[model samples]
Target: MTSKEKIISFPHMGNYYIAIEFLIKHTLNMKILTPPPITKKTLELGSKYSPDFVCVPFKYNLGNYIEALEKGANFLVQAGGGCRFGYYGEIQEQILRDLGYDFEFISILNAEDMNPFSVYGIFKKLNQKLSFTKFTYYFALTLKIAEIIDKIEEYIRENIGFEVKEGSFEQLQKDFLNRLKTVKGFRDIDKIYKKYNILFRNIEINKPKNPIKVGVVGELYVVMEPFSNYFIEKELAKKGIQITRFITVTYLFKNHPKEKELIKFSGKYLKYAIGADGTDSVARTKQLAEAGYDGVIHVKPFGCTPEVNAMPMLQNISNDYKMPVLYFSFDSQTSETGIKTRLEAFYDMLLMKREKQKWKKVI
Candidate 1:
């Protein structure tokens, strides 16, 4: 591959983006292209080209690979899973080749067949020509920033809806991220943490008179990647809707055991794990609805079986709880306009429901 050949990957999750940024910073003469956010169009294009029986995520990623190659990306990176996704790279590679795009593909996996190692190796390779001490120092700093980003994003997801200033959390988050890129050491991380902690903690947030709380649940990728869902959380926050999303890197890596408890929380409603994130999502949505959330948003990649199977059950839960639910299936070509319109309608319905509840309480 030429030194100028670009490596590309789709935004499957937020942490992947952070890891990619770290990798990109270390590689020499290599451009890393992050695919555009998945939308309806992305899904349509993916579905049009992909095998009908393949899962939704496969189609979405396939679309991303094809689109990225068309846009001059000559190298592709696939990372995720010891399950179905572990083998997705080969299938995607073949599909892309059949489509006539020439590219080098890298699969990031560890010896144990778990964890993303190519990501680490890429950074290591980039640091090879430099001082070992300096490389370790910078790599440590980058890892700290990645951890902080995860923590801060979790906080924001849980509380952004209640923020007094509609976009305060997101704006501070952006500032914090920008600051993170400039930090160089442990001292810098501490300073950055303290500064943002105080800034976010001091913001005056009001409890809405009738808060429209919405819980978002679905496949891991679509839930975390803002590009995939078109910034759905931000849109909900702007509408003063309190949002709760159960999936996060922290939950996936550190809290797997707690998932059993969560499954129990879902009661007897959903039995058997569908696949990947399907089981967790169904459980979380049930709990959220029972907890008096005004609405739920279930997002998945187009044609995802586990999520697709959960939809009817979600609708049943919606009907039983009298809560509104919106489903979004994303791919590389998904339409932004349609997503926004559906969200607007969902918000209006939730707001009206809140009003009715308030009136009932007053009576």
Candidate 2:
């Protein structure tokens, strides 16, 4: 069977699918099928086949694979990372094979470790005629695309709450993402980003002098994928809270601080890199607290060991600074209603705290 006829797909994790698709299409010689968007059906399907206690992301990925496979995706890819995440590809591959699906998978583990020769070998296996130079170009372009998107998103998170016209930020963001799908090279990515940057700035806003500011720090997947966390950031924004999140592909691939740096940034609250994104969560929360942000929300999938490990340290920091920290754990069985209710209460409490501070100043 000729491999050129195969279709490639990877699990969706937010608007980053455009970057993933751009890389695969430009570098590899196979057709790409963007997985169906995550939905209730996707979660249910993923949960059904997944191990009873596995983290929810694992189930979501499996569900994405099944949906893609059903749509004729014979080639699959999974990202690699630290903690339980690094081993996900092998286990998912095993489970899929046992379920009788025939497909190819590559777990491109860890961005730091994917050197030129390793990348060349991986791509060469799929397309023997692959040009290392060409692949390298597109790969760099892919990283650039991801970096640009991360900056745009950080801006959106900060300003999305204060837009004078509802959905202006969101609608502009949607258009920008659609434009990303058609990018051909570095020039295209730069043009799209520049265009959107101006447009995003021009959107009118009525931000208060002291808006309720919140920083989000958590497990990588939950922080990056809005759906995974019940769109917690969106809910916060809907309450007119200015949101800031430092985690993104740019942080992971381009600007991730070293272990020692993470410890230093986190202050005495953390002395060790707590594995995966755990240390960064602690550090970013500390930074947010010191920066006078109103609160922090830390999210993770149920049973995620790294984020769980960081919780005590987070609480310590929260206590030290009197900063409020909200925690949410997601699972296949997590309730939408419970999440919304807790979020509403959290927003109200933050508002109350800010009002109380003002009254004390008045006296």
Which candidate tops lDDT? 2
**lDDT values for all models:** 0.71, 0.88
Candidate 2 lDDT tens digits, 1-363: 235488999998888998888878877889999998999888998898888988998888999999999898998898666778777788889998889888888877455456667877888888888899988888888888898889899889989999999999988988998888888877888899899999999999999998999999998888898888999999999999899988898888678888899999988898778888899999999999999999999999998889999999999999999999999999999999999999989988898999999999999
Query: How does each model score on TM-score?
Result: 0.76, 0.97
lDDT of 1 by residue, 1-363 (tens): 554545655534564465456645654346767776555666676677777766566766777776777677887776555236567778777877888777878666422433334344554553465555555555565556766777777677667877866668777877887777666568988998888988888877876565678899988777876766789998888777777887766566545545466567667767665667777777888889889898899998777777888888788888888988899887555688999999999888887887898799999
- What is the lDDT, from 0 to 100, of the residue 72 in candidate 1? 79
State each candidate's clash count: 12, 0
